[model samples]
Target: MNYKDLEFSTYPGFDEYILVKNLVDTPVKYKRGASYETIYNNEFNKWQDFFCQQYQVPAGKDVLLLHCCSWAKPYDFSIIINPIKQIADKYKNVHRVIMSNVGVVPYEFQMNETFCGYDFMNVDNEEKNVQEINHLYAKSLEERLFQYLESHIDRYKQVVLYSRPINMGNAPAVKNACERAGIPLIIEPNIDIYVKYRQKKYKQLDELFIEKECLDSLDKTLQLVGEKVGS
Candidate 1:
C-alpha cells in the first residue's frame, strides 16, 4: 500500500497513529495494548528491518545525526530546522539522519509511512529500569547504532553528530559509535543554557539541541564543508 494512501489518525498520544501493520506489506500483530515505546520490535519478521533498510547516505554529502522526535517528520521541529538553516546552503549538502529507536532513518525517508507513521521516541526512559543501562532494550539499540556508524562511516565525506552540547543531553550511543568509528563529532554547546530550559520547557529528546552554540557550530561545519567541496 502507498504511504500516501494510509488514513490519517488523530490519536491522543501521538501526532498521528499510523499502524505499523498498515505501513508495510508484511502482516504484523502487536500484543494487547502495546504502546509504541514498549512494543517489541519484530525485526526478523520484517517489521523493523524494512525501515532500517531505508537509511542511505548520498554521494559526497556529510551526515548529520539527530535523535528521533515526537513529530512524524523530524525536520518539522524548529530545533532541527533552525540549526540547519544557519549553515551554508552549498555546504548544506548533508544527509540528515535520525537515530531512531527501531533503526536509523535518512531525512529523505522521514515522510515514508514506515518512518513518520509510528510513535516510539522516549529515549531517556528507554530502558526497563530508568537507572539501569545494561538492559536488553538499550543494548540492542546501541548495537544497531554502532553497526550503523561502522558500516556507513566511509560513505560520507564526514560524519558529525553536531548537536547542542550538554553534559548528558546528547545521545551516548551516537557519541560512542562515532568515537569507535573515529568520526568527527562537534559537541560543545552551552550546558548552562540547556539546563536552564531543560527542566521547565523541554519534554522531548530532540528539544535538548535547542542551543545557540549548536547552531553556530553547525554553521561553521557546513561552511567548512562548502570550502572543502569547493562549492
Candidate 2:
C-alpha cells in the first residue's frame, strides 16, 4: 500500500525540533547512552532554553501571553482557544503567544507544518512515584518559565499573562517565575474566580474561561495596558 506522503517539511532552521522531540520522547532510563540523572536534569530545562533563544524577538515589544490547555498544539484561534487574542489587537507591538505546558509557544510557530503534529507544551514520559516525579517535572517547567522570563524581561517592555485560575493553565508557574525574576507582569482576570470553579476539579482551563465575565476582565486589563503602552 503506497501511502501518499503527507505534505510536510521541517523548517530549515528548526532542524533541532527532531532532536528535541526525541529527547522528550526518551524513556525514564533514557535509552540513549547518557546518564539518567543528566538526561532528567536537562530534558525540560535545556530544551525549552533552546526554543526561547531560537525564536526570540526584538527588544521593546509587549508580549500578550495566553493559555491554551484545550488545544495543546494551538494552531489557530477559536472561542475556547483565544478570546483574549482579540483584546490584544488593541495594543500595538504586542506579540501573541501561547505559554504552553513546556515553554513559550509563539503564535506564528503554532502553525508550522512540524509544530502542528505535537504538543510542545507537555511531557508525557511515564515514570514511577507518580506524584513525586510529576512534581519534579513541575519544577523543571517552572525553571524553564523563569529562564524565558528572565531572558525576555530585559528585551520585552511588558508582559501580560492572560490565564484561568488553574494549574492546568500554568498561572502558578508564571507567578513564581515573575516573582523570582522580579519581572513586572500584568495578570488578567485578576479576581478570585478560583473558589467558584473549585467544584469542577480543573484538569483544564476551558470551562472557567468560557464565562463572559472572565473575558471582560481580560479585556479590561488589556485596556489598561493600551493606556500604559500608548497603543
Candidate 3:
C-alpha cells in the first residue's frame, strides 16, 4: 500500500489514526543510511540553537526544557534522544531540567518510569516502553507541572521549554501556564488523528453499551417476564 496515499491532506490530524491507517493506506518504510544520522544531528543542533535563541536563555541558569523522546527512527537513532544533554551542554544557564517522553506501557507503569527519569514520550510507538511512556505522559505532566510550580517558581518562570512530536491535550495544565504566565506553548505537526480516533471510539463504545445494557435488557425482560405473565 502507498501509505502516503491516505486521504489525509497533511492537515495534521491525530497521529494514532495516521499510524493505524498508515499500514492500510501505504506501506511502512523507513529509509536507512549513515547520512541519515549526519543530517539528523545537524537538524538537532539547529533546533537546540533555535530554542536557546528563541528563549534568550542567559548563561548559567537551570533550564526547564521538555522535549519528545521520539522522532523519525533515523533521527531517534541519532539525535532526537539526547535533547536534554544537548541543551544542557550548549547553554551554560541550563542548570536544571524537567522533561518527559512517550511511553510503551500503561500509564501506571509509565508514571514510575517517568519519576525515575526515563522521559520516553512517544506513546504511539509499538514498543512497550514508548506506549507506556505516552500512557502516563499526561498524569506525569500534571505531576511535573505541580512539582515545578511548588518548588521552583523562579526556575519554572524562566524555563526554556520545547515539546514536539507528542501531543499535550487541551487541559488545565496547558491552559494554566498560558493564562498565568506567558509561557508560549508550541506544538509542532499540528495534526491530531489520535484525538479524533479516541473521540470516535468513545462514541462507538457508548452506543454499544447502550444497546447491550438498555436494549438487550428490555428484550430479555420481555422474553422472560412477558412469557411468565401471559402463561
Candidate 4:
C-alpha cells in the first residue's frame, strides 16, 4: 500500500506511514462475525510451539498479555497498567507483553521502544483540520490493527483490551479483529468503576456527569455493532 497514493485529510506523519506499511505487509479478508474456530485453535498451538522453538524458551512457560490504546489519557494509563503490573509481579516466566496503539507510548514501557513516533494529541492545525487528521489517523490505526491481528492472532496468550467503551478508539477495531480471528477478548471493566470512584471521591457532579456519559456511549456502541453483525 503506497500511502502517498491514498488521500488523507492532512499530510501523513511517520507513525501513519508505519501503520500503512504494516497494513500492506499483512493482508487478510475481514468479515464481521466470521467463524474461525478451527483455524484459531490450530494456530494458537502452532504459535506457542514456534515461539518456544525460536526463542529456546521452555514450552511450558506462561505468557501474560495486556493492551491499551496509544492515545490513552493519564487515567486510562492507570486503568490498563495496574492489572498488568499485579499479574506480572505475581508470576514468573511471563515473558511476552504487547501494547497496541498509534503514537504515544506508555511511560512504563518506554524502554521497550514499541511506541510510534508521533503524538496524536499534538497535531497543530485548525480545529477542523485537526479533527480531520485525527479521523484519518484513527482509520489508519483500525485498518492496520485488523491486518495485524489476522496475521498474529495465535501469538497472543491472552488479550486484555483497555479503552473508553464509548470511543471507537482502538476497542471496536480490536473487538472486530478478535472476532474475525476467533479470539476471546478480555475487556477490563475498570473504566466504569474508575469513573464511579472519581464521582464519589470528588463529589463533583458536573465533571463526573461528563465522565459518566461514557457508559451510555458504550451501550450505544455495542448496540450499533450488534445491529451491524445481525444485519
Candidate 5:
C-alpha cells in the first residue's frame, strides 16, 4: 500500500515522511507472531539468502558482527552494505560477522576471511539455565549481544556490531557495548530509506484507500465496530 493509502506519524529523521501507511496490511508486527510462518517464512528466508549472497562484506582486522531477528517488517533483510567486501578487505584489521536467527553463514561469499563460529541470539529466553537469557530484557539485550561480540573481539583489532529490533531499545545496547569495548559500531541503514521510498510511492494513492493520521480514533472505531485493528 502507498503512503496516501494509510496514515502514520512522521518518522524521527524524516519529518516530512510518514513512517507507515497501511501498517495493518503490513507484516512487520505479526511477522513475529503466530501467523508469521504462513505469511513471511519463505519470503524472509529468501531475503536472508539474497542479502547473504549480494553484499560483499569488508574484511578487516576488526570484526563487526550483527545479530538481528529480521532486517525489518514484511521480513526483508537486504540492507545496503557500502562496498561490503571492500570495507572488509580495507580494514585488514577488521573482520565482520553477522550473527542472526539463522546460525549458518554463507561461507562462499566470504573470500580470504576468518571464519568465526556462528553464534545464536536467544531473543526469547527459552533456554533454561542460561544466565544471559535470565538477565535478558529489552534494555539489556544490546549489552548482552555486545558481550557476545566482545568474547570474540580479541581475534580482531576492532569489532563493529549491529542487530535487528526484535525487542525495543536494542540499538542502544549494541551502541553502548561497542562504546565500552572501544570498538566501532555500525547499524543497518535501509529501513528508513525503504520507509521513505514507501512514503513517496504511496504519496498519491486513492483517497478511499488513504489512512488517516488518527490511529487512536481508528482503534476506537475498530473496537466499537468489532473489526481487527493494528497497534
Candidate 6:
C-alpha cells in the first residue's frame, strides 16, 4: 500500500482535505549498519559528558534512577510514573533521574519538581515513521536507557529501574544491564488492571484496543525479562 495515495481530512468546519502525497512520496534514508549497542554507546558518551558539564555532584551521592519508557501522552506518563514515584519517595538518598527523548511534561501532571535531574536525549526525532528506515529505533531507545544505567552503576549506592517491558529490541539489553549492575528491575505493574480501571473511570474507549495491545506487549516483555534475569 502506497501511503502517498492517501488524503487526510481536517476538522468538522473545514471542508478541504489535505493531500499528503508529497509528504509520503519522499522515502526516508536510513543509516547503514545501525545497531542498539552502537547507538547506545554514542548516546551514552554524549549524555555522560553533558551531565558532567551541567551538574556538579559529590563522589559518594546515591542515585535512584527511574528509567521511563517512551510515552506519547501526558496521561501515560502519570499512570506509569506515579506508582514508581511513590516507591522512590521512600528513600532519602535516592536522587531522582528522569530521561526522555523530548523534555515535554504536561502542565496538568505537574511533575517539574518530581525529578531531581533530567536527561533530554533527542533520539526519537532522528527516527523515521517508515519501518525499514527506522527498524532499530525501539532497540536504540532501550539500549540508550541501558547505557545510562551502565554508566552510573558504580557511581550510585543502589540503582532501581522502573520501565514498562513493551519493546523487544531492548529487553535483552535491560536484562544484561540489570545483571551487570546487580540491581533489581521493576517491569510492568498490572497494566491490564490499569487499563480496565481507566476504561471504567474515564469512559474513553476510542483507543481501548490500542492501549490493551500495548499493555499486553508490555506484559509479554516483562515475562521475557524475568526469564532472562532468572537464567
Best by lDDT: 2
User: Using TM-score as the measure, which candidate wins?
Assistant: 2
lDDT of 5 by residue, 1-231 (tens): 223454446545434222333323424322222122322244334333333333334343344434333232211112323223233333333344433333222223221111121222334535563444323433334444454445545543443333332233345666676777667654433234223333444432211112222222222322332222222
For all candidates in order, the CA lDDT equals: 0.49, 0.54, 0.32, 0.38, 0.35, 0.39
Q: Write the per-residue lDDT of candidate 2 for residues 53-137, one digit (tens) a residue.
A: 6546544456545555345444444556656556655666676666543345556555442334433223444455445544554
Please give each candidate's TM-score.
0.61, 0.63, 0.32, 0.43, 0.31, 0.39
- State candidate 5's TM-score: 0.31
The stretch of ten residues in a row with the least summed lDDT in candidate 2 is 30-39
Off by over 4 Å in 1: 1-23, 27-40, 43-56, 72-90, 121-129, 132-138, 164-170, 188-208, 211-213, 225-230
* Per-residue lDDT of model 1, residues 55-116, tens digit only: 34566665554544445344444555545533533454665565544455555544444444
Q: Where is model 6 more than 4 Å wrong at Cα?
A: 1-48, 52-63, 69-87, 102-135, 166-172, 180-184, 188-231
lDDT of 6 by residue, 74-191 (tens): 2224555544444443444444455443221211222222222222233464545334324454544445445555556655555444443344333344556566667665544334
Candidate 1: worst-modelled 10 consecutive residues by lDDT: 28-37
Collision pairs in model 2: 102-121
- Candidate 4, superposed: residue stretches over 4 Å from native: 1-64, 69-118, 194-231
The Cα error of candidate 4 at residue 102, in Å, is 4.4
Could you tell which candidate, 2 or 3, scores higher by lDDT?
A: 2
- Please give the ranking of all candidate structures by lDDT, highest first, separated by commas: 2, 1, 6, 4, 5, 3
Candidate 2 TM-score, true structure as reference: 0.63
Kindly state the number of residue pairs that clash in model 4.
0
